[model samples]
Target: MTAVVHPAALPADLRAATIRTRVTVPLRFPDGYSTSAEVMTFHGLADGREHLLLALGGWEQVLLDGAAAPLVRVHSECMTGDVFGSERCDCGPQLREAVEDITATGGFLLYLRQEGRGIGLYSKLDAYALQDQGLDTYDANLALGHGEDERDYAAAAQMLRAVGAARVRLLSNNPDKAAQLTALGIDIEEQVATGVHLSEANSRYLAAKRDRTGHTLQLSRAGVVRPAKAAAGKAPGHSGMLARVDALVPGLRARAEEAEQLRRLPAVTVQELQDAGVFRILAPAGVGGYGLGAQSYGEAVRVLARGCASTAWTAGHLTEHAWMLARWPREVQEEVFANGHMPLAAATSAPVGSARKVPGGYAISGHWSFASGVMHSQWALLAVQLDGVRLQALVPNADLQLLDAWHTDGLRGTGSNDLRADGLFVPGHRMMDWAQLTGPDNPGSLLHRDPLIHAPMTTLLNLVAPAVAVGSAEYALDLFRHQLLMHKERNGSFVRQADSVLAQARYARAAGAVSTAQLHWQAALSLLPSEGQADAGLPEAQRAPFRLSLALAAEAAQEAVRLAAGGSGGSMHRLSHPLQRIQRDVGVLLNHPTLGIDPILEQAGRGLLGLELTMRSF
Candidate 1:
């Protein structure tokens, strides 16, 4: 009920010594926009500040002297295209750009991370899978039961209070968000332009936001929410599978030893990520959707991670994918999401085949790799390479075959099989260039580059791995603790080994490690909103932290597994043991290229060190 301030945690003397009157920060902008930072100082810094550059384009500071109120900003979240400049949305750039503009000019950003409007990273991805089929943002939301925008500024307001700010100006494009902040008691200092800078990739999205949602862009919110074509009967929120699946975790773990060797992801796992609503995660309100914010999305992921790792990973990925697809043109979406089997769990990677340029569309051919949930997917995304660039082709199962390919040491039940496409025809409009996305100037781009479209892709995809690893570790540790209690209550021993002092030490250690990683997981998710500022000269800083997320999660994953195994003892090695699966799963996760020498991770570490060196402190 009350907000607590968490200023620098150090001696008062040291804190005072480091306190400043003005803060410096890197300004991040969306992929294609640029601006000078002079206005930031005059308008925002008129009173002066003791500031610190928290990130590129994104940061917070004590303003106009310590007595002044604090400020907040919930920068949008979009990784794939955002951090990597993938061209899906302008989120990454917007984040950094906004920060620099606000912090330098005269304000603070609350950084209320709501990536993909709270559909979570993976669900946004599923939306992309649908986008290849042709759906606009609203249509996709309708199909998923996800709101038009899944974001909230509550935490940001809380964070501001922590820094001692009672009232402040809010910088954003959406009037709804600003009003919400004002209602919540966050002082609205002023409204500023945070739209994705113009780029051919995101022109349409900008137009849609301005037109449909009253986004205060150059467009009008008239017919933007209109169905591009016809509504698919399956509209968002129609599917309630995610909720059902999430309820199974605690009960499944109640019978730990017996829960082992359970291959059915549906029957054995319980967590928010695996619930019924998961299917409609990307669908909008008119169609039925929660349209939660990034905090909720991340919270759901964290909750699921407490149960079964594989299940959480699969569910999160599928859910995010659903949202991303929600932003495509209406006709394209209807073909995929509106039919009786519209909510399909299918996708293809690897572009195992080829496509030839043809009239109207490309005659596509290929075998896709790692098509997770292929058995459940009526539609699939097959990646193609044409004109020296990769393009995604959305097609129906009628044109493709599910090939047995997802057999792996971990997450086996995910059904990530390969799809074989001997010869398929993807219409010209059915495909788009991966690099053509730049939010502000989008033509077909904005209409498709919904919030999730801009999220860092590799970062989001890799999240599944960590979620699974951490959840598996949680389940394993919970089982181990339960076993210890049963031994003590029965006044009995566990194979003569459970009574040992080592077991007690390990139990605490494993629990602590799992908890530690979980904390870090939340910490990493918190960084999602601070990726960019509005005034960065380049995209370097925004790119680094997103890259670092992979490593941060990987570290958390390893710590979780090590602690879980340490607590379990030798019995964890049994073939039928759940620990065995967890062990394999974490191991497999460690091998993720994103963690193994990933440039992103390296960049994050560098960024951290660079900032410290620059400021002579954090």
Candidate 2:
């Protein structure tokens, strides 16, 4: 264990520590976000362990201007989460965010090597073991004969003073950091709360910190957003929802790798999506939803994909499932939406299950694969073959088994697991025939006056894949451009790639592809048959054209990402790079049956030639 000597014990007029070494280093994060830091080591008296201070952004200019206090963060190290991407704690994300936030302004990040909060790594792991057997983090430490928190900020205060940061805007949620520094003669101009990095694996740990240690963590599980005040001439629903999600983009991008490692959407991400009202976009306004149509829903999914494709994929499907549930019998809809909120449901039609006719309902049994968002869903929409007919069955999650079978090379965070059911009884009211569910005169249409409820299900479902594809490809292009502009080669300038004519041509081609994809997407949206009009029950000829446009959009999106990936250099091949992940995600998305270029194109041809439609999904 590292020894700690409290700075308060020393004389009030103590001298500042001398700087031992100072060096500048170019830094590259796993997400391909690049920056530089002036790393400094100090000669200190208290706590002899080596600690680092990274001066980021324009520190000298900030000091010279004296307009704002320098942002500072005294971060304690956690090897498990920080280095290995462990989900047991929020250390990794906090550290990553602190660096980026401080770098945005002129600031310092004091990376203290106080592993395990000064209890040492081994003891921390021991505490984790105790936690597994029913102990909070603090209690676990206390059980092992250690203070609830062994961390001391004496060294941190010294480092800040040595770096001439007598006053700073401390970026931390822990009040202890500010209190300790203030007691040790540092002026904490402000104690800014860090973004809450909550995950399913660390929810309890964070709660423990908040309740036990008085950390300023706003842990809102439901993620309810307050109503915005009405403004004259401002577009309502869509803009409000978009603004909420736009604010969450940075946090989502930061947690993308962590979500992938967990093989599911984190709690914080799910909450953020819920807060943004993405899941409620399809439900009728009577049920407290936005009552928006496919166009709005698709736009939101595209926006979400720019941050994390897996999240967008899962969220898009979950949103669609809510719309699907509206087609069920009125009683079932009432039950599902009785809680005054949109229900989270996951659906799968592939590897169809079998359902047997019973007295009150059907008994569902079989394994369904690729149920995206199932981990967080309260209900599962299982497509089953009953005798010779296909039907949709709504089964509560309690009745179905969720298998951790979503292991894949792409879109790993979706948690698209396999769901199993053995004689699970689903009431007749909750079951609807496949034809009626997608038909124009479905139950939802009769109940809700909104034209969206009467829209074609096939076309709406087909739009989801391309929205994710296009958004991910666009993000890839942005990352690649940033890489060319920021990352410098050993013997070349950072702008060298930007100046290359060939590189500019490639970038232009990629941009054109993205624009083309977006055009196709808009064309598809435009083709939506006007519900409550003469075209309400549109034929296959009209719908097939929509699918064709989406297929082309998906193809163009993939091509754009391919171009960006080719030019992103070898450094982006690392698993942590966002560009590489976007490439893999778009590749997998193009393989979806809804966006299959060959089948969709062939179906369009069949429709045009006045032939029968062969593609069931289309």
Candidate 3:
């Protein structure tokens, strides 16, 4: 779909003073219009029916009339969002939505043809081309020798004045736009906000406008805007990262204890993740599942991590799988629910198994490792080859023997180990392929396409293991600080280990790196769509980069632990010391391929340079 370019008028004085403004036009509004004149377009506006386009472009506008007043609009255009609907900016929505609201309120809109802060369309487009190469708008403009904000607004003021618009309640978010017109002898009786809302698309753009570009905006309010509507089911933790973490701490603790004790999550803990009347999270509230994260699930994972990295990691992985499982068609879920809420555990990594297609489904045989918290699970989901397809098949846990291979150096409490499915039978309906997650097939994919499934298995597998690294690092920092203070008070000194400047620097360095690494993990987890989308599988292009990010974060965590563990000197070598356990855990964590720095860095370099990323044998 072609991109839409709706330009705003230059400021009141420069209106058409530099670049050519579109035809100076007058708008007529009809009182009580139902907001469905829909879109009146300039000759060049793009179609909005396309999803990507709708997501990428601003709405179009038509002239309108109001009941109590003539609906006058500030009808300026933006080069960034209006043209590209770049998530980094809000100009597109600001231009289009203003027209829509005015159309609904029986108002007239002044369509300004300003582009790229008034440097003109060609220059603006050129700037965008440069930006795609990593330059910001300022540098891009400078590269072209166009001054920032080259817009001329005198044309717009004259057009409005010519149209007999003596007074207006200007629709605008930028105080500059409003003030400019007011100063132009066009009485802005009032200012109505018509700024584009924030989204993953235009956050950076908004920030740039308010910061580098000097656009006057009430940015505080922008952060509070929400979608006109939310998805059907959102989790309690979706509000924000901190809130999600705080809300899930209790649940995380419950899961950890359950894992530590070699059991399943208690009924209360499971129920807490579910909403009233849902059997599991997939079933609608009326069906015994908490339909959380139709809005709130992502926020839940972030916050949960802050309190306990292991718990958050475990929950995020498990919850994401649960979301995928639950999205299966309602009829399919009904059949499953017939057995009551079944406890299922999925391996974070692909199991080394194969499936042979059979009449009904396929015979599945293989064992998947690192099935944490599996002891209490009634069923095991093994990714096996069925007719050569990588299928996630549900089998009775009894059919799979626990390998008891969870003797890991860290995350000792996770109880993650191998589960063997020597040979298991699965009905056609009981088995699904990993690709069906992104395919048009699968009822679940149709209702919910979780991008989580699309994520490269290795990268995701790394996330499952690295939370322990985060947890240990955090715990280590906490211990180091606590110990230093205790030692100081006991010794009547202002400095304990920190008394030595080197030690102080060590703690600070470790703390900062650990915090940064912790945040990186949190960011990756947070980026997963609240509801898994078809793209959950990170595209091949992104896998290597993500692997690199994983490596960087993991390496950071390792160094953090190393600094702290060594900073405490020989004291931390004692088995009973918390630092010892943290050291051991962090050390073990670094061995995971996902956590290993070298491989990840190499893969990342390959991706960035567009070189082949060969899979290196572990």
Candidate 4:
């Protein structure tokens, strides 16, 4: 009902804030978006500030029954940017977006008279002059003897209580807003991330906000939601998979810990992957799959890893295995795809088993390690040496025994455990020669004639590791910045690590490392043949360099994560902290045999010097 002032916290003579008046106003934006608002004025504010609330949609009725927390945006006034078409800041676009979104969702836009982050109009212009001298937004404020951000939520909180809004879903990217309002007695049910409004002029300004003030702006996701692709059955291709996987990120992130504790991907996560058509991204359209290529696969994996590394690793490997399965004989493919559904399979490329030729097949026996996605897979492809020839033996899951040996520090949700087969017999049709399978004239390529099927195995598999590294590092950076601005000290005061010069420098370095990793990762992807192009297979000379780029990217990603983790104080190491989990997960990803920096570097050197590749995979 009224402002939630703490007992003995306010002077007895202080007046209680109350709603003074309300008026209906129709609003139209430059982009032609139109909405009407019930603008309400406030009186008796503690600070005597001239604050207002534009109540939109059915906000009052929603508050009447307490059915849900209304969405709200607590925006500060910015005359130059909000009123003018200034590109130096995102304030104009954000205000427009807030009005449109809040109207649709039934909420209020609390417009406070705190210009230029609580500095007067003339002071903000002075800071802009200082910014022209190469100082960042925050540094310019400090140069003018003002705090990085001087705005407070006391008056805004008073207005919200006056309107009977005790709880809300905060629509903001700045954690400071949420932290302040939460401290001022508002129940923030959620912190909804806003769309990134970026331009050439404001890139640096946005970066400063992200690194120095912990704003949740992802430069990669630059615009709002795009138009939906054609219906699912139209074979919407790679872009469709990107959107589909993007939709699954929230659920995947929510289950990251459950996956870790179970030491395997949760069964529900597996189902969600299947429902989302994730396993079909690499499969050929002939079998009702996307028939996409390397670049698309890499992009999808990177996006998925931002949610959960273990889920990405497992799903990524499984999707690759689907493409690998198509390399088998036409008869074997028929047996597997006969059900008219994309088959889930797990594969281990390590040649660690033995096989003996039988009358109509081979009796294979071996212990395979790192069988990712095995728990949910129906078939497994194991590498075995038969009469000194390397072959991949395809066996139904029923013929093998799964070993409980998947305990590890990171990516534990991958379920990359051991599988054992004691003299198990595999049909002759299921065995594929490793050389022929990875060669240019593989059966899948002859049948489907898709460029993706003709791509080199090493080149394609290497895409996932670096993508995972880049994504996890990006997630860590976001978390690190948010904590720097929002995490609390033992005495219940804000830590404000972003105010520290050392933390800002560390954040800048880590952010740079992540950008470097992305560059290398994209370079590696560019070397692969496009989905529409015919792949004649990559030459050894090209393959070695591609591998080198991926290795470099992985190394850079690890460096970024390590830098962020190091700057994070002792509290970050707690088991419950996500940063620690990410740190551990990236550590395990870097140690992957394919991403081993030493071997990759040596191979690159050999290729440059015109020497033979020492490694079989290269």
lDDT of each: 0.52, 0.80, 0.53, 0.82
**TM-score: model 2 vs. ground truth:** 0.67
In TM-score terms, which candidate is top?
2
Cα lDDT tens digits, model 3, 172-206, are 66666666666556677777766546553343355
Best by lDDT: 4
Backbone clash pairs in model 2 (N, Cα, C under 3 Å; residues 3+ apart or in different chains), count = 0
lDDT of 2 at 380: 93
Model 3 lDDT-worst window of ten: 49-58
**Residue lDDT tens for model 1, 216-327:** 7642111111112222333332123234334545433332222223332433232222233554544443234444333345445545555545555666666655654554
Off by over 4 Å in 2: 1-235, 238-240, 487-489, 492-495, 529-537, 609-617
lDDT digits (tens) for residues 216-333 of candidate 2: 9865532223233322222247666667556666656766776787889889788767766777877776665667666677888888898899998998999888888887768988
List ranges where model 1 is wrong by over 4 Å. Answer: 1-246, 251-275, 339-342, 351-353, 437-459, 488-499, 530-543, 597-600, 609-618
